[model samples]
Target: MQSKLLAPYEIREMTFKNRVVMSPMCMYAVEKKDGIVTDFHFTHYGSRAVGQVGLIMLEATAVLPEGRISEQDLGIWSDDQIAGLKKLVAHLHKSGAKVGIQLAHAGRKAQVPGPIYSATKLAFSEKYQTPEALTIPQIETVVSAFQKAVKRAEAAGFDVIEIHAAHGYLVNQFLSPLVNRREDQYGGPIGNRYQFLNEIIEAVRSEWTKPLFVRISAEDYAQEGVHLEDYLMMSRWLRDQGVDLIDVSTGGVIPLEAYDVYPGYQVQYADRIRKKVGIATGAVGMITTGNQAEEILRNERADLVFIGRELLRDPYWVKTSAKLLNAEDQLEVPTPYQRGWR
Candidate 1:
């Protein structure tokens, strides 16, 4: 029997070996002052590739120095960072997994030394300092930073470029009304709030021709924040901008909200966006097993399944799940691990 979870999925020119994608989880492993890929990243991602993950989305790499979530986050703000990233991409390719990088800006959540920037001047919490609101010219600079980062990602030979517009990041801050209090062109109505992201997608498209994805916080879990319906509207605009997929996740636009979270918690958002917006979607959050991933695809809820913490907990989860689902022959078990599988 065929399993949808183990089937190939194509977006543009890249064809993933299976529907399984290792979601970009921050490693914070950069040892040097410059955020370059260290040996740790090579081994960490390579092991997952060896485990037969169809796609590997690299961590949220900062597009600007001040945009880093923490001091040790990976960065692509300079050309010098390209070589190490190129090497990492090559290493993953050897394991037959398509590679991607999530370009991101931390916004008010950035815990760096200098000033933090956001759509509004509000602090995320009492512990965090108030962020400086970005001016119009500063906003243009942010778009340019993403454009330059896309060019570098192209030079790095990545198969996909995922714009990090979700999880209360810079783009998410601009999209959510609860945080974006500006009365200017960048704020006000939903269309106005989408201006920053629209510009980013346009900018990234100018440089990248391969598969493009945007990770979005579909449900803010707050009345004032974005909801699934809003994301459906946003996904339409994203489709217009040539975005290939929406990596659907929820509730990072503000502090954690009271929401029931079980396995496949956010899959419903993915299903809504895919069905209503008429675009492909990737289901994420709490998707831990192959059976759960297969059911999402079998029901036509989503096109891709993003496995996060589970992949970290077990790099070989895909292989184990393949066996559990009796689809072992469908996935490529590396030669050294074939004996164990039998």
Candidate 2:
């Protein structure tokens, strides 16, 4: 049987060689705390490209210094950072892989040495700092930061750009009713809460015409927390605003002691959003095997399968998957590795 998992997928003008996407995971590898790409990044991501992964979505890179989840997070807040990223993208492209970046802000979750900001003054937990609530003007500044980050990402030649609106980050904070307690235009009703992301999307669209993606936590796992119903509507809004895809992830909107965890756990949310909202979605979370990934694509559950820990455990996961699915003919093993694959 032809392998849908190994099939080419396209968005806008960029075409992925296969359906595998390297899910964005923070490496926290910037040695100088200057938020620039380093040798570690090159070595780490290069292996995945060499392994023939179709689209390599980079870790959450901060859009502002204070927005960093940690001081070591990569940054695109400055024009100075472009050269390093450009080289990285070129390196990946040389290996016949498309490159993407996640533009992010840590919000109240930021652990750096500065005053953190969020939609409210609440800390994530007792161990975290109480963030100062962002004033209306301050909110606009953060939006501008995301917009500027897009220009830098475009300069770096990224084939795709994903807004980091999930995992209890800055954008997620605004989206979650559990966190955003303000009574202003930026808060309250779901549409008002969505206003922040809407503006950021508009700003990014002005500078970027490439395929854009928005990552969202589809289930908050807390009562009255942002749920699937909320996301279904917001996802529609995202699609209407020209977002090419929704990267569906769950939890991290609020701290959770424990939750369900099994293979393909998050696929249902991706499936629901894709069917109900009529938009492309990427399924993530615990989807660790080739057969499982194939099932998702074959059943039309999600357009792409984002491999996280599995890819980290094996850089050549695509090759392993090809073998498992007996679809080695679909993969173009690098010339040097041709004998091994055969």
TM-scores, one per candidate = 0.98, 0.99
| Residue-by-residue lDDT tens digits, candidate 1, 208-271 | 9999999999999898888988888889999989999999998887887377898888999999
Model 2 over residues 106-161: C-alpha lDDT tens digits?
A: 99999999799999998999888999999989998999999899989988999999
TM-score of 2: 0.99
User: What lDDT does model 1 reach?
Assistant: 0.94
RMSD of each: 0.9, 0.7
Query: What is the alpha-carbon RMSD of candidate 1 to the true structure?
Result: 0.9
lDDT of 1 at 53: 94
Q: Please give the range of 10 consecutive residues that has the lowest summed lDDT in model 2.
A: 333-342
